[model samples]
Target: MKNSNTSDNKDMEMKYVMVIETSDYLHRLEANQLNLFTQKLHNGISKLLKKFDSQILKQDDNTYIVLFDSVTNAILCALKVKSNFKYITLKFDKSIRHLKIGIAHHTNRIAAQTLSTRMCEVVKNQIVITSEVKKAYEKENRNTFINKEHIRTLNFSEEQFLTNLMNCVETIWNNSDFSIVDFSKPLKYSKSQVYRKMISLTGKPPSSFIRDFRLNRAMHLMYDRKGNITEIAQQTGFKNPSYFSKCFKDKFGVTPKTYSKQHAN
Candidate 1:
């Protein structure tokens, strides 16, 4: 098993996208029907690519992996597979199991099997071909996706601790109940101690770290409903709408209402 970046051809290897099983595919189909559907699925995927510069492997009965030459090719493959969710037909059956796709560029060093399982789990969580996945698939933004925000804390470089922190943060990501105190509660360190550790390691206060998270949430909610400024502020955990407005101005250099108006136009 080859890892993501370990494919040797760095210039050619953009990413490996895993097409995961998203439904109860075995619920109704007989073994022969299942085989037929799988064949159709494979042929459908191969047909999407204009130039077959990469390998498409049948990892299992249901899962497929496509190694594409570039991020554009990967995104094209992902969108193609997702679009087929509404179009694919079997020979004897009118419908088949739907699929969800997950894509990650070849940058990290993880085992191939582990990467496959993790990608499958991720694709299952994301039913759609998500905007994050789509944005990461862009040529100019591809580096930003895998590189820009990934700051590994050097002093407290414990994998389990980082994993736990990520899990806790992601679990309550959109919840207003998530705070620095809540994030520190399960870390086996006192609140102040955890604050100091994060500052020493990551060069910022824990509250400062999540400030961007909340601000980004606010921006996302703005796009969701173009005119609901106060409601978006409260939803992002800003108790004072005025203060939230100020923060938004400071970050994006535009007031929430003005930004909303611009987007609305």
Candidate 2:
């Protein structure tokens, strides 16, 4: 290894690096769906980064590595991206519901690379920063780091619970037979416990959550022009096309056929 003093000196250089990636569920989507989701995500992130004077150094599928000359801009960009995530994914058929961000302040490209690699472990919908970044941000701004609305970090148990819950939903969401019992089995939580926890966290009970998830997927499929109404309904786990059309109308204010025609390419 190189001398410790040399590494320290290199780290003293002024550069900020930010890494962003969507939830693990993105990898579970079909290729077409994945492309559509990432494209939308990238567009939204690019628009936000423009306000911060940052450059995207690299991007691989859903993961983006961004570089900034100013720590304040990097931190502000992270906060902005996190705040706008839901809006960014609003048009997606199956949304990328969360983003995990890691920000670091370093002197050189090598040190920035190392810092970004370690930040990959950050939890979903969370923003994590190095001590250097935290210090630099406070020095540049009058506000304390803890006072920021976007600085919230989930505890390990809460992170794990959300991860498991989301993974479970993604895995079984396309099954027409999927029910509250099926939803609870993978989580190992009883129906009532899962019900309360989901409501507390998402403000929607399990059944409504699953239904909304399905309806969202169906809407995306229509946008993609993936198939006719019947096939889209079946693919998204609705028991019948009529029921799917009714739900679609209830959620979207128009029937599926009308949506398909209006959005057709």
Candidate 3:
């Protein structure tokens, strides 16, 4: 184990780590098969996180780094995805790896070193969290999956809804005054029906989708060199750059300043 953090700030600040690791299944696949399946696995989990108003921060090959909004919700999502993976893999003739995870709460104070590196190290060391989280997820799997209506009610697939949702998100991502009501207005469904349909289709409410969409777009703009953080935030519908930085840091585990520095290198 790495040195134990002795900082007093540990209790006051909340930090979390989520690791998505595949088991022995990866070793069996050919190169093409490995790339294809891994990409699909990443997209699958990425979509699930967006629905939960979270984002995958960084990824190392098959290991994904995600800063979940909360520990409980994160665990539930991991379990749901893990449970669904078996079903998804059935269609493929080639072998595919199974997804499992490690979750850890970092209470240590933010030091001068890189936050992302430390977060990854601690979580990797705590392999026990993977099994513990997996167990807890299984216990809730029945309610989480059995009751969910996997069938499409609107004669549309989740992928279709996600595509449409992204269109809406892109349209409104630059408008500061944009609201869920505004975002939903363009849908073919009724306004009242749009909310529930969106919730059912995406596993997230309209409001969360809108907000997360903006933040994500802002982050993209940052990495793309479209503009600096403040400009990117404002252009992506955030009026207050400070508030934008706070939200970005909370969801991504690093301030925009720090993130930009790392990416610039």
In order, candidate lDDTs are 0.54, 0.71, 0.56
* lDDT of each residue in 1-265, candidate 3, tens digit only: 7446743333333345566666224423445666777787778877887776554556754667666545557656756776767766777543333444555444432320123222222212212233333344446564642122321112224334444655576566688887667756676666667677666644457766566667656666665578998888888888999989998877555688886765563
**Candidate 1, residues 97-161: lDDT per residue as tens digits?**
44555554444423332343333432223322323344555444645443222211111233244
RMSD of candidate 3 to true structure, Å: 20.2
Per-residue lDDT, model 2, residue 235, is 95
Error of 1 at 77 (Å): 19
lDDT winner between 1 and 3, please give it: 3
Candidate 1 Cα misplacement greater than 4 A, ranges: 1-159, 171-179, 200-202
* Per-model TM against the reference: 0.42, 0.56, 0.42
The candidate that wins on TM-score is 2
TM-score of 1: 0.42
- Alpha-carbon lDDT of model 2: 0.71
Q: Any runs in candidate 3 off by more than 4 Å, and if so which?
A: 1-160
Among all windows of 10 consecutive residues in model 3, the one with the lowest summed lDDT is 146-155
